[model samples]
Target: MEEEKMEAEDPNHNNWERRPESPPELPAPPEPAAPCRRRCDSSGGRALLGISGSTSKFLMNVITVDDYRSTYWPKLESAIDQLLTQSPGDYIPISYEQIYSCVYKCVCQQHSEQMYSDLMRKIACHLERVSQDLQVSSPAHYIEKFNLALGQYMGALQSIVPLFIYMNKFYIETKLNRDLKDDLIQLFTDHVADKHIYSLMPLLIEAQSTPFQVTPSTMASIVKGLHTLRPEWVQLAPTLFSKFIPNILPPAMESELQDYAAQDIKLQQELMQNGFARGDQSRKRAGDELAYNGASSCGSSQGYR
Candidate 1:
């Protein structure tokens, strides 16, 4: 066997070629791949933008000029510049939020109340057209969709009181495009004053009771709305908010209810304690069972011996 091994090791005896080491085998080079940008066709992107983008779009659509300039104008300018680079005034996938922001800025004027009436009408019409797309689309399409849902859901718990509170803050703190101010007033008169802003009034009050606070300006504005428009909305107002007048409301409100905060904290604490206690008991029981079994086995072994 040793002789055969020696024979095999003999350099000239077999397939051994005396050569310097060949280059290490390399993995085959990967082929070039196409770039996969996050995009859809013009209309498809627009359709997706509907659900995720509409709330921000709608907020932009309704905000006054000063509000836009202060809160959103810079972002709008950047989006527009990028949009122009892609396809002139009308980019195929221009977001609903972008379009609304641009239109609001374009038509707004500092002192005049006439510029936006026509524009507002156009916006309302456009919103109606996009309704089908917006209603059915997914929320993940836009970055702001979750924020919007969170806002709406939180608002719903308190009957959407926060929306009005936000509206009030923007209205008084910011000098609006006069046209938008008037338009909002008119729209509110038509929709809320004439009907059931008060129907949800009780729910709003209940939410307010939860320790959710309001800003001074915001609170004042709500009072103004209630005092001025209560009569118009009374007949249609739901039973809950009727207490708006009978009860002198609190001077302020919080962003979220206090009770909800308390409950959430309590639940978290209970879960943590219960989990810890259960785990501790389980470990102790297992240790005890193991010791008992060991003791019983040892006694049996001694008796057998």
Candidate 2:
């Protein structure tokens, strides 16, 4: 009775008969906070990640002009040289994909203009070297050497175009409003073709006059190359022949025709047998047809047909 009275008086006192206390109720789980929306910078740049503009700029390792020239241009230039110099059977020092990535990075780093200019300068330098070499070649071998160099340059360009496709799209086509391949071809015209046109003209005339002096395929390539370099010439009246030939060969045409006429049927047969003719026609007939076509075309063109 005394203990019960004491427990009642002191509420803090424990009693064995009392029920165990229940665990305190946990605070209701907090409602999930709404997701924070990312905000893009005013300049249309990437979304900010709590970083100040200056800090973001500082963090980016933007390549400078000098940095690109020193770090990347040399490697790209070396790859181009390898492509231009290597023969079909030779080993390539750099892979096409590596060169392409280099160009792509340059363009991405805001060096598109510099990269474009550098490539143009490099190609111009190469054409200048080719021009110098051609200038020293003997007349007997001039066309052959020119054709070989042209083929090499063209082949190298085919490889280069794909490698620089990004730069071509971003810088060349967009900013300069020019086609890379066309510009390169123009460089060839300015650096090589124009410089040697006078000397080459006589060779072309001689080849035409003397049937076997240059193979027909070689002649065709020369003609096609000239036409390709000066597409505007195609707009001229005599679309049948390379316009440069007509523009330059007017004085020699009559003489060339006379010489062709004087050649025997045996010469014509030889020409036809040598794949000069277009199809399975008789050699004599094809040769006569070729002669007639040549004469008519030459007659129609004031300068070139």
Candidate 3:
């Protein structure tokens, strides 16, 4: 027994101890499957998905796969419904104030030049009706009441006139729809001739203040109106000249007393030109000095002097 135990304990004895069990091998990880690509319909199917052609095109050009479900896909669905709606205007869930706000926004915050033109044309048409109403009614009392209401409405919508004018001018300049431009210009001219330009002063002021890229049709009217009305400092020049400068203050009663403005813009322009020339000369002198110093650093003698 001692011998057997000694043999079992021997370092090189095969029977001394059971062979150590081989380590179990782990199974290889299953191959990752290729991701499935979603095939979206392209031929007007995207339109059915509620995406506007423009939005769809933009999405296709710029949107990524990860963002599709989150941003583009939802918008696409909404766009489809909006596009297919028979009357989106009717569907718009807004209050009366919101409607007015939208109208005002169309006038004041219009982004597209074409949209602005359309809005101005609509406003001009409304104004034409108002002018017609003013013309047909012979009673001063009725006219006064009507004028007050119309003035209030115009005042409320005043914020957008500049936008309308801008689009109108762009349309005219581009000759996009010359007939509309001619008609609108004629309408404005007639309104000025009728001496109703005063009523539009509030809107004119707001319009002039807009820094939009498009030029206001009101500018042409302003220049011509100014020449005709020769409004003093306080008085509003004809609506045509509403483009001369922003209306900082309302036409005062004092305007009725004066025939012309005291300050001559032409003279101011000349003074500005002189100042600009002086400034240019000063800058040139400074630049020359810098050049002279640079030359001096190189041990060169050349200079303006």
Candidate 4:
């Protein structure tokens, strides 16, 4: 066997590594993709007040406001229906955060007015349907059923109240001159509890026969809490001086006539009035029965007062 010849090399050469003829260069870091700008339609672009190009970028998944309205709104409606179900443990299938975010975006995009009107109409329609769907079997439980329906309806709407309030301040309070809560209550009362409230009206009125069960503070609260939405005049204080032909004044509050107006002037008249103070001697007054112009409270003031 022929002896293998050793190639000549310096001892230091072992320490030096041999380099490949051509080293593969690391690929240059890919140019950062241009800030993924999206071209949105007229309704979506930055030119529009609320929604900007940035919104489009963030909401890349959101096609357009109309698209959200068509798709997501229906999903929201489905969730609402689920909330309205009779099952006590029932919950909406859709994510609340996602729905709220969608609503927020829509409102922020200057689609607020349309969104507000649409929401109101949809809510009203649902309330009407709920009113019809409710079963009132026992006459005794009519109020109970009505209360339950109101509670369920309110629960279904509770999640959306924040969204409702967003437009309520701008649209309902300003343009409509109405309270959203009052409006919703009115709707429920009209559609669900109309008859119950009608029958229970006399119970709520403060009269000689029906003495106030609550304290002064509670009465104040009731007056403040129960704002009437109806057009008929509903005063917080029942006046004894009504049905004045020309000018009929209340009886003098003081024992004797203590006139604010001087007696000398032809137009001026001095008058004493009977005042009811916080611990007055005359706590009770006669003729307390409130005479309703119309017996039906179904057409009564929708508001609390």
Candidate 5:
């Protein structure tokens, strides 16, 4: 009875005795929506999604090696011909910017090796032609022609090197560990200068020995030009003179010099004899004139007295 009365007095007595009601079941969470699928279009090769149309076209339309060669090589060849054939100081017919673009594209397309090889071959051919032309020149004119050709070729290279700067820096310098200009110069030396060096040596020696016979400027041009193409030639001239002069001079020039020296001595002695005879005659005439003047003065003074 005391427990019941206490329970009744408690405001929570019935609630404590009653079982707690279970919470109503919540509906299952809705399934997450599927991600929207973007199907890539497969026509005309695989299309790059999220890229601009121009970029996509550029990637898709890759230029094959053959295509590059076919489409651009003729243009390049023609331009090179124009560059090589143009007279010194003449305006270039081809556009430098256009060639630069083509070369840049070729290098970017990984065609540098082929392009470099073809360019070298073309240059070698041009040099070969130049060598043949130089070979046919008369010995008297050989140095002049060679100097002219060298100047023209080097001038053309000045125009060419800039056009190929991209390929030269990226492929020639980096991969081959060579300088483009040096390689081109070497080509000229090998094909043109070196081949003719032996034949040219005698003329060069003669010109140097008697510089007055040839224009000093012409001799200087040839020497400087050859030296530029082949630095070793500077030392070579002295070496050649030291080794060959003794043997060569006696056979060729020494006899001529001795003959001229004998003739010169005879002529000089004859001139000296003539001079002395003229001096003696002048002295005798001066004495005679003085004696006549003295006689004339004496006669005049006597007559006056």
Candidate 6:
């Protein structure tokens, strides 16, 4: 009964909770299909029963990913180089399948760290060249050129982002990490956008306040583009819509004073009247209690005398 009560108290309890299962009865060993069988041959002997390459590798304990790393690393770097050197508006044909395969192999080989580091370095170096190519001496044209180069680079890197994320499903995402697109955005901002694009916010707002060389549409695009680079820092909506709050704090007594200010003379008079009447009623009640106590004291003293 106690056990039944305990089980009844447990809302999730069920009659068929899991327990150790008894071992199932095994079938008798099958008869050998082959005429002859070999046990562990070392002299390049034929496999006992239709052994494939992977099966042979498993048997011999020769399975390794060193060859995969060696084979794919150079190809990966070469594709990145092509991405860097390709001409403007000329789309270099990239074999996405091969790149994804390389990344997948690297992940399989437990070489994702090396691959990620190499990718960061290569992409950073290439982006440095892009930043240099788009450098402008004029502060006025700085935002324009940086933005243009940023767009071009992003367009170029569009094809490569998918391949970089091929390994994200298995390893990178589980660690609570950023993805390839986010990394690329960081690289671009660090190398290119941070210098010219992000620094223009106050200046751009100033210009928006007044007339400027860059048109309103271009300025809008600049703000939008900056948002794409760093979302937290870019809030052009308030600036664009002329929405602003003065930094000056309200007076300390503003809340109490505002209530008084909100009331007209007639309303204030009515409030004072109600408060005075309540106070008088309380005082009158106290006076009546005191008089009754004095009378009771006098009557008791006379009766005692």
Best by lDDT: 2
Which structure among the candidates has the greatest TM-score? Answer: 2
What overall lDDT, based on C-alpha atoms, would model 3 receive against the true structure?
0.36
Q: Write the per-residue lDDT of candidate 4 for residues 23-129, one digit (tens) a residue.
A: 12322112111222122112344554355756655643333576656754675566456555534334434444444444544444455567666766776787777
Output the worst ten-in-a-row residue range by lDDT, candidate 2. Answer: 32-41
Instruction: Give the per-residue lDDT digits (tens) of candidate 2, residues 185-211.
Output: 889999998898778767777787666
Q: Best to worst by TM-score, what's the order?
A: 2, 5, 6, 4, 3, 1
Span of 10 residues, lowest total lDDT, candidate 1: 32-41
Residue lDDT tens for model 1, 11-42: 33333232211112222111111110111111
- How many steric overlaps are in each model, in order? 10, 4, 10, 14, 0, 0
Q: Is candidate 3 or candidate 5 better by lDDT?
A: 5
The CA lDDT of each predicted structure is 0.34, 0.64, 0.36, 0.43, 0.62, 0.53
Which regions of candidate 1 deviate over 4 angstroms?
1-117, 123-180, 192-194, 209-305
Ten residues in a row with the worst lDDT in model 5?
32-41
Summarize candidate 3's per-residue lDDT along 1-305 as a digit string, tens digits.
43343233232423222211111222211111111001111122453456576854443333334333343233323322332232312232212222222222222222224344444555455556766666565442332434343333333232233322433443334445553334544544555324554544444455444332114443444433434333452244333243344443344344432222222233335557546332444556777877864554332111100
Model 2 clash pairs are 240-305, 241-305, 246-303, 246-304
Scanning candidate 4 in windows of ten residues, the lowest lDDT window is: 1-10
Question: What ranking of all candidate models by lDDT puts the best one first?
Answer: 2, 5, 6, 4, 3, 1
Clashes of 3: 10
Residue 39 local lDDT, model 5: 14
Of 3 and 6, the candidate ranking higher by TM-score? 6
List candidate 3 stretches off by more than 4 Å.
1-111, 158-305
Write down the TM-score of every candidate.
Answer: 0.22, 0.62, 0.25, 0.44, 0.59, 0.50
